[model samples]
Target: MEAPVSADKLRFLIYRFKERLWVKPLTFCLLSIAAVFFAKIIDGTPLAEHLPIIEQSSVETLLSIMASSMLVIATFSTGTMVNAYTSASNSSTPRSVSLIIADDVSQNALSTFVGAFIFSVVAITSLKNAFYGDAGVFMLFVLTCTVFAIVILTFIRWVDSIARLGRVGSTIQKVEDAAMKAIDHRLNNPRLGGFVQPNLTALKEQGAEPVYCEQTGYVQLVDMTKAQNWCEHHNACLHILVLPGDFVSPNNPVALIERTATNPTSNKASFESTEAAACEANDIIKVGHERSFEGDPRFGLIVLGEIAARALSPSVNDPGTAISIIGSYVRLFLCWAKKDEIRDKPTDEIVQFTRVSAPELNTKDMFNDAFSPIARDGANIIEVAIRMQKALQVIAKCENKDIQKYAQEQASIAYKKSMNTFQFEEDKGRLDETKWSD
Candidate 1:
């Protein structure tokens, strides 16, 4: 949940916007074109006079070589990226593919090569028109040399990054970093700096304006600021019905508006205002086909869990990856729980929390989302089950009761699933020997 799509307040939109495949390349293309314009403007300048001039044939040959090479490089990069995305979608969670494809190093490298190609093309086209004077040619020549150096450097880095792209551990780390940023934001603004939600009166059944969802999709974001300000303007309270990451249909309500205007008004006007507010609220709630990670920390957890699930599948059968993911899950939980502890502690710098009425991410939900699939897939494997148990036991030792409760609950489920999987007394006995409490 966040304010409307203002670049500063809408956290999720900012995250997605920055990672777009075109942002960097488009920017660099514009810069490259700007360079050509600057060269033309400075054609008679002293700066251009000091620049070295090359033969027209030499410039033409270089431009042709660069244009052709860059075209091939761009194609190769695109193909490689597609392969990486496909591999990540299959090997890791499908959700993870977004982050892998948006990686900075790869995107920048592609942008560099692509921009170089455009620069060469523009220069060659202008050359045919006889646009470049002696000074402009010298400037263009210097610029070409600079672009060449960048292409070489970027190609090296791009190769290094491609080698690790789509890897399970790398993808997991990326997901973890995203989750941590979201967790930090929540820890700072648990209520989104709004009023407490749990105690807020449920007015939807009591004549509140209903904001119906228009489509079936996950609730990606709710512009709480716009909604809150609108409600304030009308002397009403904006109540969010579904938080980000929750799936909804057209039948489901996204928010409920309770009219709290103290002035007695005609029923006709009141009804009109309430309906208008509902319409505006609907505009503020942004639903999308896929869940995003900006405000939804659970998305990261779910993705990491999916990675473990794939590893435990019979076809992939990689217990080591499962074990590694168990540790990762534990670390992720500790990060979340530790932040909760920090936020709860009283300090001079701490301000009173504005506890907005949104769904609290339950420890049980995290446990179920992260472990159930793994438990189901690795039921027959004792080693995986043991690692799962130990991972839970570690979290269970923490003082957080919800964490302990969830850890114990998943532990019981893991054991029960193993009960059916183990045919012999020895395997069953081995599982039973260790205790979640201990």
Candidate 2:
């Protein structure tokens, strides 16, 4: 006959143990069952006879099973506690003392006790069956493995953080000033100007042997007899000095028909007698002259050159300007390629011709032409131009207003010069190889 009070107290304690932290206990039970099943599968083999004596005996086997169960429970509880701490730290909510106390009572203290007890049971069980029967050695091995795994994971995370930090830093750094100067210098070169076909017969008769000059403002005219005859008959020597491929500045000399002593003298009496014939010849010459005058240099070049100049200028560090300039150039090139004169020429031919004639041009394949001077100098120019633009954009962001304004003006001038030169080339029929080359 147990006392009524004692029996009631015992029942209450049992109920409380079953209900308190029910989820964690249930999880432990499930893990234990899984471990038991795995052990049974491994031990039930035909080679069980050769198994260790401690593993064969029921008491030792049970201890080994308990050891595995304890290890799992300890690992699970430690991981859960770590996760909780991390989550709480990262949360945006304000921390309260009461909430912290409650968490410690319900989760930290209780869970740790449960986990540690399970691990102790498993460790003891494993030690009982271990070959050397050295519990300390087995325990040490388990601890070492756990620590090593944790260290490896932590190291990986640290490496990832470092990589992310590097990328962010680079993204925030400002642009350079030397880059802008280089870009402006390339874009504003006078060699990027337009072309003009000269009177070939007049030049030939004047004992002017065509001399190949390096950046001397003279581009050799090939197969331009038709254009030359027309200009000669019109009594106007075509301006070959301002050839479609040459870059021109306001200071560049204009092409003019100089009357040398070699030109035939006009006999007034003979001119009157054959006035209609002379007039007809003059008209033919005028038509030819008009045909030889191709309108506007390469629009693509003008737009791109201006963009490069502006982008590289120390006054403006705007990425929008670079993008805008690039976009405009792309559109203009596409449009120009579709024109009557350019339509028939291969893409390679057009690129080569433009690149060869204009050393400062920076578009892809600008130097494809064997005859283009750009092949020799274009890549260096382009690389420097790009660097300069980046540099200017960087410097502009940090510079004073007065300096910025001055830089802006300089950029504007360079841009205008580039555009003017490009336009001059486009107008002279350089964009269309058939019109100019033939």
TM-scores, each model vs. reference = 0.88, 0.21
Per-residue lDDT tens digits of candidate 1, residues 108-164? 988898898999999889877988888777777778888889999999989988998
* Regions more than 4 Å wrong, model 1: 1-10, 18-20, 51-56, 198-207, 261-271, 345-356
lDDT of 2 by residue, 1-438 (tens): 111232223432443354345555456545533443334444445654554443224444444444555456446545654444444333211121112222323343334334434543554454456523323333334443453343345435533532322121211110111122222322332222213224556665774322222233322122223323433443333333433334433344323333223345742222222333223222211111111111212322432343344434556434444444333333333332233343245555433222112222322332111102111222123333333333333333432443244334433333333334443444323222211110
The numbered model that scores best in lDDT is: 1
Give candidate 2's TM-score: 0.21
Q: How high is the CA lDDT of each candidate model?
A: 0.77, 0.33
Q: Highest TM-score among the candidates is held by which one? A: 1
